[model samples]
Target chain A: MYGMISTWRMAYEGVVNQFERLKEGEFAGNVLEASIREIEDFENFISVGYGGLPNEEGKLQLDAAYMNGSTFEIGAVAGMEDIKNPISVARLLSQDRFNIFRVGDGAKKFAESEGFLSENLLTDYSKNKWEERLKKVENEELTPYDGHDTVGTVVLDKDKNIVSGTSSSGLFMKKKGRIGDSPLPGSGFYADSDIGGATATGLGEDLMKGILSYEVVRRMGMGLSPMDAAQTSLKDFEEKLERKYGKVGAMSLVCMNNKGEWGIATNVDFTFVVATNEQEPTIYTSKRTEDGETVIEKAAAEWVEEYLSNVLTRQE
Target chain B: MYGMISTWRMAYEGVVNQFERLKEGEFAGNVLEASIREIEDFENFISVGYGGLPNEEGKLQLDAAYMNGSTFEIGAVAGMEDIKNPISVARLLSQDRFNIFRVGDGAKKFAESEGFLSENLLTDYSKNKWEERLKKVENEELTPYDGHDTVGTVVLDKDKNIVSGTSSSGLFMKKKGRIGDSPLPGSGFYADSDIGGATATGLGEDLMKGILSYEVVRRMGMGLSPMDAAQTSLKDFEEKLERKYGKVGAMSLVCMNNKGEWGIATNVDFTFVVATNEQEPTIYTSKRTEDGETVIEKAAAEWVEEYLSNVLTRQE
Candidate 1:
């Protein structure tokens, strides 16, 4: 069976667009890359790729990673700028045995040398948002960080291969050269073709503390259902963080076992997209119950429409 | 109990120098930082800090990480240049709640903002070595990558607070902005106050594929002896990598439990420094047996003398 699961409502269209190729027995890596590229190229997705928000220095530095479960080959880039498709670059780097992880100017140089387009990625919409946020921080004592919706996807192919990828501009108005979990292995993403794969989107600083993605995948490997793996890992880690660090930030994870079964867990109202051989491409929203379980439901028509309108009508 | 274990014989002096403070019941974080800082300051140690080798562009980019086991606070820097003590910078970053991991220019800026000294770290010895290596690569087509002896240390204080830190110059002649496992949590180092902590040194690319540091700590938490945890994790990962990735790189790990028990494992003849309440600070060499267990013995006086002479007598 073939299936794909990704974080956020922004991934719904990409999953829908890529389902045909996945059903046609394409490799998991190619399908995952193509799906993420669609989101990266869309200017409306302010948290990833082309029009993603800038750092405190007004530079669009992106972080992305790709992991091939079958080979344990991982590639990643962080603090990269002017790279049109960070996900594609990460996938290309995964083919190399060394220097697979690059950062800052080195990442930019490698991407450009390898023929990935280097262009100005900052759109006016994002720039205006940065400016407005900067003013509020100066005048209102507000925090300058928000909007870290990373596009993380995990795919299982007909050949039983699993691959996971993640792309993010990181926390909006973050310090220069700041990176999140998007580019980290085990924390941001983990996959093992024989068992399953998992990807995360949330406060990267807190996420890396538990290596939650790897935990989810490991639990699945140990006979836990995908849903149980995702929920228990997230809940346990969050509680541990609260007791230790005195606070916890938002966190959401998505996982899929080799059987095309998928699961999700989140502390906030999080939307995700999933499609499988037994299920149509669909968007779902998830929230944590009081008992620390996750409640997942299909996105209502009204909610989907409202989300789309918000993206389409967003302005400075 | 108080204890410290560090990769490489290069750390012996630091461990020796810091044992007094550790015995006095200093906090684990302070002792770990001070011990690593001593290594970072020693220009004779070519693999880390002041005399560390340069990247392909003749730039000295360094990587380091700091983790507090009790709070699960992690801070790291990769591809950072001109910072005298990256371990100190990492420790300082761990105190923050966000943007704890910085790379490249951002790391430098953070270091400078925090009053970390900014100065040329490339010594004449390191520069001449880089030039000589460049000639050998051009003349003989030899791989320019070597000398990745990261100084990774794990310390447990009297209060059962565990802290782990790592510092490295990365692979000699690596690509600009290339980073290994040194700065990434879970892969390079992992610590838990109640259980144990582990740190790695070797081919970071291969090491990261296994997330071996975290695996060692997890095994210890599961009630394995420190030796069993370190040996089994390294052996299992090396075999798995050989099967999947076709080859394994030289890798070594050092770990310490809260009870001051320490263990070590390596595919090569690896030397490490350890001091604990039960054992005096001493250097030991370890190698893997045919059966995949580790054989560790106190380093001989002749071997220690030769190692020091080799460092002191090297000339251009």
Candidate 2:
């Protein structure tokens, strides 16, 4: 019962592209990496990979992580620069028992030494967007922070090995060297082949405050269904954050148990992609109900088309 | 009840220095910061702050984090260089709602912009130690990585406000920009004013795989005694790591519940300092038993004297 789930509409094509290989019995880690690399290579996905938005300093610093559930091996790079595929670097680092999490220039140097290509990551589209946002921020016309849609995924293979990964350029126009939950274990992603795996996408600062991804997976381990775990953890943490911190930002989580059952929860209008042995890759929209539950349904054909087209047109 | 517990015998003086202010009703965050700052200023402690060991590049890179249990606010810095008080920077960052975690040069810049004085963190003693280790590592007589003792602390003030903080130079001779669990939330430290707080010190690479600190605090929240929580969480994670990753590293944890009760667990001979309204600041040594329980005893006068003298002599 192979299965995969990922945050955001941007992951739909990547999931679709990888389903065939996964069905052919590809390892969860490889399939997860390939799926994320697809999103990373696409220039239209402004929140991840090559063309992602730059920091306040106009540099494209990336953050990514990969975790092996069976071994509990994790590797990550935060504030990495000039690396075409941060996810691959993270995957490589996971093989080491020490210094698995590297940051900044050191991360870049490690990737380069490991033969990962160092390319100029800033595309004109993202640069223009950054410049435009910088003006508005200077004029106080808009807040400097927004658009942190991290691409996070969890995969379970035919042999039941599970893996979770996340990649992001972090918040648009964020402070230099600022990193979100994308590169953090437990907060951004957690996986255990024996139970399930979970990944999160949202305002990383607030998300890290709750370690929502790990909580979702932990709840699943405690006998809750994947859906119940996702929804209940999100609801509880969101309420706790609101009461304590006075405000809560956007948070969405996706999870899949070892049996290939999947779940999702979100506090805003959100979209995700999922594929399983019994189902083809599909796009779904989700929202939180007033009753502290999640409402998820297959997105309409038109809505899917519009979303994909919007992503493409943004490249202009 | 005002209480504080910090990892390592090095923290004894700092805990003693701050107990009076804590008893006088200083806020938990302020007391935690002040206590940690005292440790950071002490040059005798080789694993943290001033005179801390350097990375392979012969540069002192520091990591630190602060969390407010009441507000669930977190701030961290990783791979920062030339910073005198990383704990203070982390505490200041906890007040921000975004971009609270910074790394490398960006973290250094943030601290400088905040008016933190920039001083050379490396001392002659530390530099000489690094040089000697470099030769031994080159001769293949020793592994490049060792000595990762982070000063982690948890404080419960008179008002029951809780806070957790950690500071470290990371693994001695670690790669440049390598970070341990010290700056990462949940792995290094976790706090909830209504429940408890926990902090970790050891091989961060292994500690992060289990997220033990957060798990310990979560167990305490689930109604376990602090001792039970610490022992069970560490024991479980250590065994899991051994099975899955082939081996586990030396790990030690210190936790304090909001009621001022404290607990400790360690896979190695470890020492920590604690002070509460009912007890004066005192140092204790702890180790895990074969039966998965912790054995803690007050440090012998001879052992304490020898330890302090050893630290002082190392500076020569």
After TM-score superposition, what is the CA distance of residue B158 in candidate 1 from its true location, in Å?
A: 0.5
Candidate 1, Cα interface RMSD:
0.8
Chain A TM value for model 2: 0.98
Q: What is the DockQ of each candidate?
A: 0.84, 0.86
Candidate 2: count the clashes: 0
Docking class of 2: high
> After superposing candidate 2, which stretches have Cα over 4 Å from the reference?
A290-292, B290-293
In terms of lDDT, the poorest run of 10 residues in model 1 chain B is B307-316
What CAPRI class is candidate 1? high
RMSD values, in order shown: 1.3, 1.2
Which parts of model 1 have CA positions greater than 4 angstroms off?
Answer: none
Q: Which candidate wins on DockQ?
A: 2
Counting clashing residue pairs in each candidate, in order, gives: 0, 0
Alpha-carbon DockQ of candidate 2? 0.86
